[model samples]
Target: MKLYYTPGACSLAVHIALCEAGLPFTLAKVDLATHTLAEAENGSTDFYAVSPRGYVPMLQLDDGSRHTEAASLLQYVADLAPAAALLPPAGTVARLEAVGWLTLVSTELHKVFSPWLWHKETAESTREACKAKVALRFAELDRHLATRDYLAGDRFGVADAYGFAIVNWATILRMPLNPYPALQAYLSRVAARPRVREALVAEGLARD
Candidate 1:
């Protein structure tokens, strides 16, 4: 499979999970500013041809089929590598609970940061409002992380991959994590994982 992504975007979640799962795949980097691939893996510079939504984390499978959406893709990758236990097995209560964590990461954290806080044209008041909202979510994460090393279960798993990608945005975007030491520590913990570190270095988000 070929995973199309923009460096340091939420797609990094899937990239890190794929690495941890020991999956074989290539990467196609998208220029989100242009929504074009520098070298299109699916034979089109126009990313819309490969993904009509013009989004990153579009996974083109070996059969030439494709999948999109990070939440769904995270679960898909987990199922493919069940031995890795990236996610709890499907159709179980454990799986449902884990999926709930992912949904919160997506709506509360990821959506809160994007389009508003990340865009310069957004009004200062709007950015402040978004940041305020994100802070509430951050506080919740800080409290939860205070008692656990990982978000989903006993080990670093799919939810950690997704949460790390979104929550690390606080660092990248210069939001203050100093007030949430537990969340900050959790970020550091996730970043130190070998596969997560490899993904980070590969995306140029960190030095090896």
Candidate 2:
């Protein structure tokens, strides 16, 4: 499999998952500025051909099929290595809850922060609005995380990966994480994971 991604983008979640699952995959870095695979004077056209949407986190399977969406990609990678405990078993109540949190992270938290990160035109207004909304969601997760080391209880499931990937945006966007102590600790824990560290470095983020 080949995962096309931009460094430090949402695709880092899938990258971390693949590493944790012990999956062998090639990484194709995308230049988001040009929406292409290679960094060149003129961007490589190959990646855009594979994913016309021109987005990162496009997973090209062994069979040459492409899957988008970080939330769904999390499930796909988890199923690929069920023994790793990345996700609970399918069709069970526990698994259902895991999926619920994944969806929430994607739709509620991830999408809410998307607008502010990509533009400067209305970033201030959008960020102020999103700050209040994300704080509520962050507090909800903070309360839940305060009692557990990982999301979905003792295991580090897919939801935790998605959550960490989204919430880590606080640093890049200059959002305040100091107010949410539990959430702050949670990010630190996630960052300290070996696989996650590997992903962060691979995505050109700091090794620390």
Candidate 3:
């Protein structure tokens, strides 16, 4: 399989999962600012043809199929190496709970934070409103995290990876994580993981 991603985007979640799963895959860097894959030694448009959507986080499988969406991509990578515990066994209530949190992080938290960064017009009242909403959502995450080491349970799973990826946006957006100590601690814990650290470094987010 091959993964096409932009540095520091949500694709980092999928990259972290691939590392945790111990999967062998290649990576193509996308220049999202240009909406094209960076040139190979000779330069090319192959990746663009594969994903006309021109978005990062597109996973192309060996069978010539592609998977998109950070949440689904995380689950796909996790199931590849179930023994790694990226997620619990399927059909169990625990697994369902993990999926639920993944959905919340993707739609509620991730989508909510996106607008503030994409549109300059949102810099006024709109951005403040979104930030207020995010604060309430973060408080909920903080409360839940206060008692659990991970979003699903004591063990790290797919949801935590997705959550860490999206919530890390707080750093770039200046969203102020100080009020959500539990969530802040959770981010720190995930960041400390070797695989997560590897993803961060690979994405140029951290120095080797």
Model 3 worst lDDT window (10 residues): 39-48
Off by over 4 Å in 3: 40-43, 46-48
Residues 7-88, model 2: lDDT tens digits: 8788988998999999999988888787766743244456667688878788999998988999999999999998998998
Question: Ranking under TM-score, best-scoring first?
Answer: 1, 3, 2
lDDT, candidate 1, 1-208, per-residue tens: 9999999998999999999999999998999898898895556798887789998888989998998999989989998999999988889998898999999988888888987878889999999989999999889988998998988756888889999999888887888889999999999999999999999898988898
Q: Please report, in order, the local distance difference test score of every candidate based on alpha carbons.
A: 0.90, 0.86, 0.86
Per-model TM against the reference: 0.95, 0.93, 0.93
Model 3: how far residue 152 lies from native, Å: 0.7
Q: Deviation in angstroms for 136 in model 3?
A: 1.0
TM-score of 1: 0.95
Backbone clashes counted, model 3: 0
Per-residue lDDT of 25 in model 3 = 89
Model 3 lDDT tens row, 1-208:
9889888788888988898889998888988776766756245655656677768799989997987888889988999998898888899998899999999998898888875766787767778787888888899999999999999889988788788888988898777899999999999999999988998898899877
